[model samples]
Target: MNRAFNRKRDKTWMHTPEALAKHYIPYNAKFLGNTEVEAPKGTEVVEDAVRKLKFQRHIKKSEGQKVPKVELQISIYGVKILDPKTKDVHHNCQLHRISFCADDKTDKRIFTFICKDSESNKHLCYVFDSEKCAEEITLTIGQAFDLAYKKFLESGGKDVETRKQIGTLQRRIQELETENSELKKQLQDFEEQLMMVHGSPAGSISIQTQSTDVFDMVPFSPVTPLVPTQANNASPPPPPTTLPPDISKDLFGAEPFDPFTCASADFPPDIQSKLDEMQEGFKMGLTLEGTIFSLDPLDERC
Candidate 1:
C-alpha cells in the first residue's frame, strides 16, 4: 500500500505545472539621502561646475540624515526600492528616466544616481550605502541598462529595415502605375488612328470574308432574251457595212476619186467592167452579189 501511494504522489507531482523563471537582482542598501536638483538642459551645463556644486551640496545635506535599510531591486526595465520586511515599494525609477549613476572614489561602499521624478517633474539625486556590495549593485544596474539599450537598438533596426522595404515597394508600385497609364494612353491613340483609317470605331469595324471556292462566290442565273412587243415595235438595226480596202487613202484623200466620172480609158479592163456593173445596179435599185457597192444615194430598193 505504501509503495502504491508513493508512486501516485510522484505521478501527480510530475504532472503539476511549473512556474516561469523570473530575472532580477536584489541588493541590501542603506538609503543615505535624496535631494531635488536642477535638471541639466544641455551638454555645456552638464560639463559646468554647477553640477559639481549640487553634488557636493547633496552630500553635505546627507551628512546627518538617518540611514534606513532598504532593498534595491534592478531589472532590465528599471530600478526599484522596496521595504525589506513588508515588501512595500518606496521608489520606482524607470531605466529611461535615470540620467546618471556613479560610485564614490573615496568610499567603495557608496554610490549615487540622479533620476527624473514622473509626478514632480524634477531631477532628484539619490545616494546609497551598500557596504562591500556597493560596486556590485552599481555594476548590476549598468549591465541591465546595457542589455535594455541593446534590445532597443535591435528593435529600432528592424523597424528601420521594414520601413525601407515598404518605401521601395511603394516606389515600385508608383512606377508600375505610371507605366500602365502611359500604355493606356498609347492604346487609346492607336485606337483613334484605327478609327481615322477605317472611318469607324475600332470595335465597330467588320471584316468581309471572301469565299474560298470560286463557284460559291458567284451566283448562277439563266439569262433570258427580251421578246418583241407591239408597244415598243422598232425594227432591228441594219448590219454595219464593210469599208473598202484603202478607203481612207482613196475616197477621203486631199484628191478624191470620182468612179463614175472617170474615163474607162484611164482604168484597166477588169476595173472598168466592175465600175459599169456597180453603176447599173445602183440605177436599177438592186444589190448585185460579189460586187463592190457605190457610195452614192439610192431612191428605192427592191
Candidate 2:
C-alpha cells in the first residue's frame, strides 16, 4: 500500500487489536481470474475452456514459488499486512471493501479473506496462518463489518431527516409567498374603493377640488344660535304695527301687476288714456334733448 494512503486512513477512527499473526498470499490464489467462471448451459463449454487455461497459468506460477511472510494486523479500519521486523506496511484494505472471510475448509490454521485492492479496485485473497487464533481473527473481522454497516445506516438516517426538514421549510416559504400576494391584491382593491369615495386617487388630489383650510381651523360657528343664558332669557319683543311699503303698488298700481295676465282690455278706459298721455310726454322729452345737442354741433360748424 502507498504511504500516503496509509496516512489518510490513519486520520479516521479505527479500533486496533494487540494480536498479530503470520500472513501470506498463495501465489496461485493471490488474485482470481477476472473472467466469469460460471455461464449458461449453451455458453458453459466455451467458458470451461477459458477456466482451464486460467487454472494452468495459476499452477505454473505457483511452481517452486516461495511465499514471503508478513504480519497480519486486523482492525475496524480493515486488514493490514506489515513487514514483521521492519514494521513497514505491505498491503491495506478498508473494512467496507472486504467481501469475505473464513477459515480454510482443509486447513483450520489458515485464515483467508477477500478484499478489494484500493489501487486497482480488484478483489484479492489474503491468507493468514494464525495457528490457534484463526477463528478469533475471523470473528474480529465479522464484528468490524457489523460496526461499519451500522454506521452507514446511521448516516443514511440523518440524511433522510435533514431532507424532510428542508422540504417543510420550503413549503412554509411557498405559503408565505401566497399569503403575501393575496394581501397585495386586497390593498390594491382598498385603494380603488377609496378613490371612488374621495373622488380622487389614493395618494393624489385633483387641482380643481376646494381646500378645507378654514373648516380645519378652530373657533367654528354654528348656523343656529345657542340657547339663551339664564340672565338674558326673556320674552321676544313684539313686531311693529306699521306695515311695510307696497312695492308692487309703487311700481305699477294698487293691484299687483302680472305681465303674463294683464292685457290692454283689462285696463279701465280712463287709466288707459292717462298711460297714453305719459308715453307721449316721455317721447317729447327724448326729441327735445336730441334737438338741443344737434343744434350745438351745427353752431360749432358755423
Candidate 3:
C-alpha cells in the first residue's frame, strides 16, 4: 500500500450544457469574447458607381437645402428623342431605375438597403449579393430600369387588377385615336366630293361651314299630289311595292372573321375535306370495332 489506497482516488464529472451551447458551438460563441484580437478591422468604405440608367433621373434629396441623394429614378415617361435608327426617332414608353452606394469590400460583396422604385411614388428597400449569379451581371440602363420597375411593381404596384384596368384604358385610348383619324380622313373625302359637286374649290367655302356635309343642303320634300286629268295618269298605277332589304347591312363590317372558325361555308373545301377525314378517323377509333367509313363531304363543309 504505497499510496495508502491513493486517498480513495477522487473523481469528478461536470455537466455544463449551457456553457457548451455558449462556448463549444458557434451559435452564440464569439471569436475573441470582449477582447480585441490583433486582426485587421473591416473598414466599410462606400464605393460610388455611377450608372446612366434609362428613363429619367430622380434625385434622392429634397428640393430644399441639403437635398438627400436620390436612391432611385422611375421612368414613368420614356421619350426617345433620338435613336441610332432614323425610323423610330421619337417613341415614348414607361420605364424606371434605381441607384445606390455599393460596398465592394470583399469578393462576395453585398448591396445593403437597396432603394428601388416603389409604387406610384414610393421607394423599396432590400439587400442582395452581387455574387452567386447564374447569369453575368452586366450593368445597362435598360436592365437597371427593368430591375427597379419589377421590384417596385412587385411591392407597390401589386394590384394586378389595377394594372389590367390601366392596360384596358390605354388600349381604349389607342382605338379612339385611330377611329378619330379615320373619321377625319372620311370628312376630308366628303369635303372634296362636295367641292366637285359645287363646281368650286373647297377653299371657296367659309371655314366655319367647311366641315358640314354637302348632302345636308338637300332638304326634305313633301310628295305633291298629281291631277287625275293628266295624260300619264290614264295608265293604271303599279302595284304596291315591297320594302327593299336593309341597304346598310354590314356597311362597315369589313373586319376579318375569326381564323379559327372552320365550320363556315367560306372555309377552303380541301381543308374542310381533310378536317372531315380527321373527324371520321377519330370517331371510328372511339367505337369498339375499328371500322373505317367515308361520307359524302359537303362542298361547304369547311
C-alpha RMSD by candidate, in order: 52.7, 50.8, 28.7
Q: On residues 182-245, what C-alpha lDDT tens digit does candidate 2 reach at each position?
A: 6656666765664455343433322232223455422325852232211122333332233333
TM-score of 1: 0.39
Q: Rank the candidates by lDDT, best first.
A: 1, 2, 3
Could you tell me the lDDT of residue 104 within candidate 1?
59
Q: Can you write out model 3's per-residue Cα lDDT over 133-203, one digit (the tens) per residue?
A: 20112112223232333343444333433434454665675565566557656766765565455332423
lDDT of 1 by residue, 35-127 (tens): 666752222322332345446657766796455789988876678899999989999976555655555556677776666687886877777
Model 2 alpha-carbon miss at residue 114, Å:
1.5
Clash totals for all models, in order? 0, 0, 6
* Model 3: worst 10 consecutive residues (lDDT sum): 25-34
Please identify which of the two predictions, 1 or 2, would achieve the higher TM-score against the true structure. Answer: 1
Lowest summed-lDDT stretch of 10 residues in model 2?
286-295
TM-score winner between candidates 1 and 3: 1
Task: Show pairs that collide, candidate 3.
Answer: 59-70, 60-69, 60-70, 61-68, 75-95, 75-96
**Model 1 misplacement above 4 A:** 1-22, 40-65, 155-302
* Predictions in order: lDDT: 0.51, 0.42, 0.27
